[model samples]
Target: MVASTGHEPCELGPIDYLVIELPQGTTTLTEQMTDQIIRSVSDRTLRILELLIVERDGAGDLTVTEFEELTDRGLRGLDASLVEILAGEDVHNLASAIAPGRCAVVIVWEYLTATSFTAAVRASGATLVAQGRIPAQAIAATLRGDDEDA
Candidate 1:
């Protein structure tokens, strides 16, 4: 038997990507962050669909590594299955933006908490048209009345 959502089941939530840059002199993905990622996936708060690490050499060459390659470099607590969702184009595009002599860890994940709500809205014939994120710096400036200084 197969489970269904009355309508076709979708992954049903916002899929978002994050690029975390490590300035020169930083070495590897931290073990603490790896453990947090493991905890989130185990408890279903988030589903990591793709993980890519891009490194830019001082000469501006880029190297892209997928999940397994990252594991070899000490990114623990990740399952090999997540590599299946890697979007080559996505990784390449993000890699192109990295500054020389820096490294960036890119994770594409689904917000599991919003999944059921998304499904219900879809079933009701509603659709999400737009969404945006406000930078924390902007929020802080507003609260500090620093806008006047700008």
Candidate 2:
């Protein structure tokens, strides 16, 4: 069951979420990154289901804002307006992982490339039971046999 929502079993594609943190006072959302995202959306490679931002102040106070809110706060360079699809619980959950004095961009996206496979699975009455992500650092450490550090 989806958190904070009623028991409505909706058919969803291979959706995934990511929380990307930027260092304090860092502005890494360059024009190139924006262009790449626009291209992907235009090509139907993926769809931005949700977009949220979390900012942690020096005193460790957290502030969660939606896409439009962020744009209103002098972040008006993006060419797209993402939907506010995340629930309150989702914002809190993603915010909990971010560090103090840092900023994080939480995005929930659907992988269009997996549409056919997901459709097939749904047709067979096989629902996705579970899913998890292993961070890139962990994968690299395991591949290099750096178990101690990992």
Candidate 3:
């Protein structure tokens, strides 16, 4: 769901999506977290494609809110493309991951650091074979000598 950012050459990095659950009873992002995000976007580490809030009620019903309308979220300058990259099924799965009566923020971002490398690889006619991410928990478990997950 990468939309044009109206930038020339359009050499984009890897796109990534994340879901961060808000602590129960809290909807506002912490100042420290906000600062880090601002720094990352400002320094071109990432480009935001979409940002939305999902809330699951006690009855397990789901509701979504666009980040722009949530002025209290403290992400004023940061703008999302609001392209709705996540399909309905994906949103459903994300909602299922949230505990009842809680909320979470869904972020879709492009990794700017790999842009030039990807462009160079393409220029050399190299094709991407495959890509994947290893969960941090798996690394932690392996380091702790937990063979079950290893």
Candidate 4:
């Protein structure tokens, strides 16, 4: 089930009876549906922004020779300009209007941090598992029920 942020109330009764409390006024069924659609699209755009940042930072274009040396990888055919363009399209002007503080820009920033960590690990030739158990364990620890041990 999708988790709502509780900014809107949900009803379990007849669809026609559903009402949404908005800043303007109580919203009818059509307005509520429209709000839901808009929120969904915004969330999707943020996810895309996160992905683009990951791709841009992971492709080894933002850094220079030090970055290449640190990663122990050569960027022989990598196109820095193309990475910049891809990253640019990930964010839209609407992001600032809809989610100024926690918007697509924040997502991109977080992704860049994560990408840097991954690159450092890769450069060290450390036998750290990129995915699978470690991340799963961390998430499980974070999301464990109140009754479960940490």
Per-residue lDDT tens digits for candidate 2, residues 1-150, read 222236755445567888889757863444565576667777888778776678878787878766666543233433263556688887887787888888887888877777777767877888778877778899899999999857
The digit string of per-residue lDDT tens for model 3 on 30-52 reads 67867887788889898777777
Highest-scoring model, lDDT: 3
> Which stretches of candidate 4 lie above 4 Å from their native place?
1-110, 130-145, 148-150
Model 4: per-residue Cα lDDT at residue 90: 28
TM-score of each: 0.78, 0.74, 0.85, 0.20
Q: What is the lDDT of candidate 4?
A: 0.27
Order of the predicted models by lDDT, top scorer first = 3, 1, 2, 4
Better of 1 and 3 by TM-score: 3
Candidate 4 clashing pairs?
A: none
Where does candidate 1 have its weakest 10-residue lDDT segment?
72-81
Off by over 4 Å in 1: 1-8, 72-77, 80-86, 148-150
Q: Which lDDT tens digits does candidate 4 get at residues 24-127?
A: 22212234534543353345321111211111132222211111222212222222211222233323321223221121111211122244455555567764
> Superposing all C-alpha atoms, what RMSD in Å does each candidate have to the true structure?
4.3, 4.5, 2.7, 22.4
